[model samples]
Target: MRAQRVEDTPGGRLPAVADPLRPFESRSAGVATTERVLFGRLTTEDPVQAVVRRIRTAIGLGILTDGQKLPKEADLARQLGVTAFSLREALSALRDAGLIVTRVGKNGGSYVQRPPASDSIAEEQLTGLTATELRDLGDWRAVLVTYAAWLAAQRASAASSDRLASYAEELADADTAAAARRALGRFHVELAAAAQSMRLTRAELALHEEFDWLVQVLLRDETHRRAIVRTMLEVSATVRAGDAAAAWVAGEQLTAYLVTELTRSRLRLIAAGSAGPGPKRRRAGDIVAELRRISKQTVGILEDIADDVAAGVTMPPTSGELNGVVARSVLPRLGRVEDLVHGVGFMAEVGLLPEAEYWMEWWQRASDGTFDRDYSHQLDPSLDDFYEYGSQDYLTRPRATGRPNAMGPYIDHGGVDDYLVTVSLPVAREGTFLGVICIDIRVAGLERALSPWLARADGTCLVLNAESRVLLSNAVRYNVGDVLPQSSDLSLTDVGWFGWVVARAPEEP
Candidate 1:
């Protein structure tokens, strides 16, 4: 204990007991403080392991990219709130772990590196994970990246989007696991960066701590790398195109693909024999691809219609001139949409055409938000349509969020009179909510293709639409149309962009 400087009697003169927990002395350059929350403020965990984990995670995630110089020993320890000795210990451990290289002299410090993904290393990291853990990781990552893409669509400048595109190309061209790993992590961080949210970028960095290195193990395979690059490009395209709704959809699909890859990579390590093509995920992907075609199609049509509005058309007032505008500008495209486009109904608001059911297309026998189909997708691009497009759960959701959506598996009793799922992608031009372009797929058709998969699992299995309504089920305990029951035992696996696989927990043996 150091000598106390007491100012008064009765022990008041004693130097206040130095609080061990007293905030560390601030330096000329203060610690960049994300602290216990966003940035890791290690507490309760072993100091050496925590430092190792944090650095490994940073390097893996590309937050500290390859060859990036780390701060000097004293500064790093101060920033991490660890002792100088502990920081040195962690650095030595990292060197042995192949995550960093160190030098011992003046102008020498730790430099970040990405370790090779050997089967041994990957299994060591993965062995402790349960299937549930894998699923949850994918879900949370999905939420972050998807929301980021949507905001990026609205906020990113052209140069930023082009940069994302360039990054995607580099990922596709990567010939090594380390290169791919860095690109993949960098893409997510840059996407968050494009969203322009420092908090989001930091959150993404936090996620990398647990997942980045593990994901690198999967990136080693060229097939997985190519697959991810394709999805990244898709995401970049939508963001570049400035279609917020479409960007969000593409983001979810990308995450679903990542989730599938992570599962397959896990299987390759553990089951040995079970690793092969994931037919269910592939089928779900095909279905999603079929449904999502409309976003680009709809956006194109909206742009064309906007051009018409821009080119030399006089704003007709009250002289049936507005009727003429609808005829010359709107009816043709709405009456006959692209081959891939279809609709179950058309609902419009008057500012658009005064509740006009501008008939174009709807019956896409296939699929969509089990889709952000933009519930979107839509009423023949009419909302401003018949009394049909009400401000309800399905019709109004896209308009409000300005994002694509999928809703239903409920009976369209008053209309189609059969159970259906509606995929809608919203249409907006110049920030005006025009309406949605939607397709109606019969839930029965989905049930047939999905039944066997749902049945393969031992316990209760269900196929759910965007909203937790059961679309298909293997057990009678819960029938179609019932909202899925909440239970900690239930684990929901996303089946592409359109639906989820709700699995019943295994019973105690």
Candidate 2:
């Protein structure tokens, strides 16, 4: 007997297929003759891999539905800007992977296969990964999702926001686990698309292809599915409200929860001896020693700048004129010492200067030269309070009654919206505190300094303040100013002036 020809429908059933040649012929001849260029040429060195990625992505995204026939070989090759040989190789690989199927004779063509349950596929993939790998994957996704949500909040139109909200609602209303998982994936991809960057969207799609199976697995538990849906709703609401920072936080929280779930599963697997051993965890003491060295180096630079300001540059008790001179002479010196220093200035006691206003000199990396602002006039209350007495009282208060203060992750500084950390050394002569010599450093700069050490580890490293707000993090999941949860997995060490370094190995055995 001849084999029964089968095709998968959206409803997940194989139907008795008519001649595939009939569908091709019934469609306009132009349909076969013409080609639709969905994306640009493959730039990767391995053209076959690139071709495979594009087709797999399309299938994952539902751009090519199950059983949908691909274009003719020649036309597809032309559209993808690859030779027929390369395209065939990619197709063969995809077929081997069960992503596509092929038939023979006049009706022969490549058709997308009905993908397996995402959770089942994801569980299979997870079996081969070590604990550390899973954690790293989770951290990577968190960063991408956070950034995508932040950008989306900044650039999304009202209509786009509405669509995101609608997707969230759809997820909440999903009647089955399978339906909910699909809705959840769509919402995330749509969120990335709203960022208005095609590159980011493509990156997000790649992540989905790898991680969607995990998400599907998670959604199998009714309670977990509900919780995830709630988090998605929160993200949508934050993005729709146009709060970029809040949206980022929401995205991070969602990813963190997902990571926690995956970690628990990994631990269970480890106990079962299903997974092999992972890399050795780095000693916390080693990380602390390295951070101490970096902190001392930073403090040494600040102290030298302070000495120059206190000696050569004089701040006359009542004359604002000397403020300019102090800035001109000292700000340039501060800039010379460190390229990462964002700004340097002196804040005088109120009414000590001629203008009865505090003097401030600020320099941004983007700015050509130092500019002046009113330290007491236009500064945010949180910052103004910090410089005046908050620094000595809050940050430096613990070390010595009187010493330098490092205050950070402050928003609304230098007339721009950026997170900053300031190191202030009280400049005093003869028991009189002349003013505080303050240096501003972008939090991003600090992260770059610690990135090398972080890269050596198998988990995330966060530099956080005493209050648990982040100062710098290797995992972009937590931004400056976001509060971190206290967990037993986190190895917390005090870095003195900088704050505590919280290292958490996601793959900890």
Which candidate's TM-score is highest? 2
Best by lDDT: 2
Runs of candidate 2 exceeding 4 Å displacement: 1-38, 104-107, 173-179, 273-509
**Candidate 1: regions farther than 4 A off:** 1-50, 62-69, 106-108, 111-114, 217-223, 273-509
Q: Give one digit per residue, the lDDT tens place, for model 2 in 1-509.
A: 22223323332222223222121213221111111223445667899988888788666644456777777787678767889999999999999989999988876888899566455566666544543356568877888889989998898776566666666676677675555665666666677777776666666666776676566667678788778878887888888889999999999999988877765554343334422342224222355675676556656765675566556544465454555556655655644545446666666544455555544554445556444443433434456444343333322442244676677677644344566777766665555555666667665555434444554556666777767887755454554577887664576777765455555556446
After the best TM-score superposition of candidate 1, give how far the Cα of residue 277 lies from its true spot, in angstroms: 25
RMSD of 1: 22.6
Instruction: State the lDDT at 118 in candidate 1.
Output: 62
The lDDT values for all models are 0.58, 0.62
In candidate 1, what residue range of length 10 has the lowest lDDT sum?
A: 26-35
| Candidate 1 lDDT over residue span 325-411, tens digit each | 434654456544542233433333335643434322223323431211123233444445333455545558778876556677666
Candidate 2 least-lDDT 10 residues = 28-37
